[model samples]
Target: MHIVLSGYYGFENVGDEAILLSIITALRKAKPEVEITVLSNNPASTAKTYGVQAVNRWKLKEVSAVLKQADGLISGGGSLLQDQTGMKSIPYYCGIIRIAKFHKKPVFVYAQGMGPIHKSMSQFITKNTLNKVEQITIRDEASKQLLVDIGVNKSMTVVPDPVIGLDASAFRSEWLERQAFESGYISVSVRDWPSEVNFKQKIVESLDLLARSGHNIVFIPMHDEHDEKASFELANMMSEKSLVAPGNLSIEEKITVIGQSDLLIGMRLHSLIFSAIQATPFIAISYDPKIDAFATIANQPNIGHVEKDDWNGEQLFDKAVDMLAERSSIEQALREQVMTLQSDAQNTALMAIDTFK
Candidate 1:
């Protein structure tokens, strides 16, 4: 079987890459002989980096040809169905599925997280496009509910995010080397501009408190540009007491670094997700509903939006400290949940590919 996998591939985002890695692992386990292809923004980078055949996103004629020859098109495991990132997100992703369907290819939306759609056109585009899909496996109950709210009546099942299925065993050696510095460290992974939150001040305050309590401070970025950029900015606004990981670390290296931290505070969705999967206690900073929903359903503590105007640097820091204090029990409570999530996510990929037959 020839399977064309689509998502935000070729991008330098570690979270998206982790999701792709998870799906590819599951797909291979299910069907070892299948030939895989990816739709990528930078075909060369993707092919060289991942060892998969890549086609440019804008190559419609080529895409059409691949769709005709491929057994199924898999729109992958990410929050690609939402428009909150930008207006172009919906049309760019949905158009790919529509194109695949135009050639009568089976399209499966696999382990996807759905909307906090802020635009009418985005909602319309997503709802209409999803209505035509052969199957959809949403990653969470909240995402599944969002699809129902949007009027997508096609068959849908709730699974966990594919990143949950990632094996920490892949980073065991790297984790061992970094574990010393993390003995009493508090790690923070920040992403997205929090217009509503005073991120710089709050994070600095949190780091200060943790430092005074004799805890070392480190930063992990789920995405090199997004999380690392914001983390650097926050580190600059604070004293030299904190350390931020280099922006050039690979996905496995980031996981290794994150695994060493005693506690994690993250604004990016996958940072917290990775923390959960690694059994690291975390507090999430929510800039959107998706972040809030992920934390809430996972039963994780979070300092969500305090409204754009009401956000206080001090208040946010205090919440994070309180969450950190509860780390041990919180981490213990999350194990059973994470185990179920891991199994469910793996099954989703297996089931999604089976839909093609």
Candidate 2:
């Protein structure tokens, strides 16, 4: 079976990369002899890293050719159907699904997180395109609800995010010794997002407070290039004992680093997801509804928007301290939830490929 996978691949976004990694893992487990092809922005790197045939996602001719030859196309496990990022997002992803359908190929909308699609045209495109899929499995209830709101009344199951099922035991990093990470080390992952002007400064204040309380701070950039600048800027603003991790760490390396941390204070969804997979307690700094949704699903506290007008550094610090106090119980709950999510993620892949069988 030749399956073409599509999404924000090759963007160097750690979260999306992790989702691809997990999806590939699950697909292979279900059908070891299946042939895989990826539509990616950076085809060469993605092909090399994932050991699959990759084609440029933007090249219409190449995409059509792949759709013609592939047995099926798997759309996504991320926020691909949303227009909140831009108007192009909805059309671009749905366009691929439309092409696959044109080729009469079975297209599975796999574990997708649906939108904040506010525009009427985007909603129409989403509902019409998605209704033609062979199967659809959403990653969250919010996504399913969004689909309904958009008038996509097709049956779709709610599954866990693919990364939740990734096996962390396969990757190891010597980051603890290399960075001299200490006993009470807190892993902080931040990203650049449109927010209140003083967001970075407030985050710096919270980290400073955490450091003063005797916790070592380790700044992790999940996407080396995308996240590095913001992480370094925040690190520079802090007077605390802190180390900014190298930006080029692999997905496994990032996971290992989060696993080794005493706690995770993160804005990236995957940063929090990795913490859960490792059974590490975390406090989410919400910048998107996806973050809050993940926190609610995992039963963790989301300390509100990181850049809200009334953003309070003291409130964030207090939440972190309170979460740390109950770390043991939190970790236990996270582990139990991860086990269930892992199973759900695996089922997502199995269901996607069932059409081939």
Candidate 3:
């Protein structure tokens, strides 16, 4: 069987690539003979980076041909269904679903995170496309509820974030070598959220305490080049004595670096997800429902919601300090959930492939 997987790919977003990799790996394990093609922005680079065939996102003629020749299309496990980024994002994705259906190929909305959708036309398009899809597997209960609220049905099943299922065992032991850098440091990851939250103050307070206590400070940027730049800006804003991680690292290196943290404060969903899966202590900053939902699901109940204007650095730091004592227990629980999510996600993909067969 041939599978066409779609999402915000070829953008160098670690979370996006990680989800694609996870789904592809799951499919391979369940069906080794499967032929896979990824729809990406820079098809050549994506093909080169992932070692998979790629077609341009807008090349529907080519995509339709692939859909005609393939088993099913997988519209992935990321937040691609939202209109917050662009008006075209939802229509563009749902258009693929509609085209796949037009060619008599099944479409599986696999492990996707649903919206904060505000567009009526996008909603109409999504409802139409979702109603006809062969399967819909969402990563969190919050996304599932969002779909239900938008009039989609029980056709959806809960799958954990695919990143949790990634094979990071290769770098597990490397954390031992770099543990010294994080001995007394607090690590923070910044993302484009909670502009309403007092995040700047939170970072300042946390780092100030760590600095006063003679501890190291680390900042992790999960999104773009500007992330670390923002970190540096925050560092300077606070006191200019902060240790900012240079944004010169690759995704694997970023994960490795995060593993070296004593306590991680983050707004990036996958950063926190990876930390939990790897037995790292993390305090999550919630700017969206998914973050809060994941925190509740992980039972780490102390997630700080950054008010767009409040940016409470002290509260975040205090939470980070509190999390240090519970790392072992939190890690154990998170691991259990991670395994369950991985197993369920694998089974869902396998079952979807079986329908194609």
lDDT of each: 0.79, 0.89, 0.76
Q: Find the 10 residues in a row with the least total lDDT in model 1.
A: 173-182
Q: Give one digit per residue, the lDDT tens place, for model 3 in 121-167.
A: 87777887899988888878888888888888648888777777776
Candidate 2 global TM-score? 0.97
Q: 267 in model 1: Cα distance from truth in Å?
A: 0.4
- Tens-place lDDT per residue, model 2, 1-357, is 999999999999899999999999999998898899999999999999999999999998999999999999999978898888789998999999999999999988888878788999999999999889888898788888888988898898988989999999878887656765446689999999886557777778888999999998889998877788989889988888688888888899999989888889899999999999999988888887889889998888777686675766787888889888988888898899899889888888889889756
Candidate 1 lDDT tens digits, 1-357: 889998988777888888888888888878887688889889898878767788997888888788889998999888898876678888988989998898899999988888888787887898999999899888778888888888889878877888888878668435436545635677788775736455557667767767766777788777776777777887787764778887668777777677667777787788888788888877777777767878886787776563454555566557767767787787788777888888877788788668887
Top-lDDT structure, candidate number: 2
lDDT of 2: 0.89
Per-model C-alpha RMSD: 2.2, 1.3, 2.5
Off by over 4 Å in 1: 172-182, 194-197, 306-326
Judge candidate 1 against the unseen true structure and give its global Cα lDDT, from 0 to 1: 0.79
Worst 10 residues of 3 by lDDT: 172-181
Residue 77 lDDT (model 3): 78
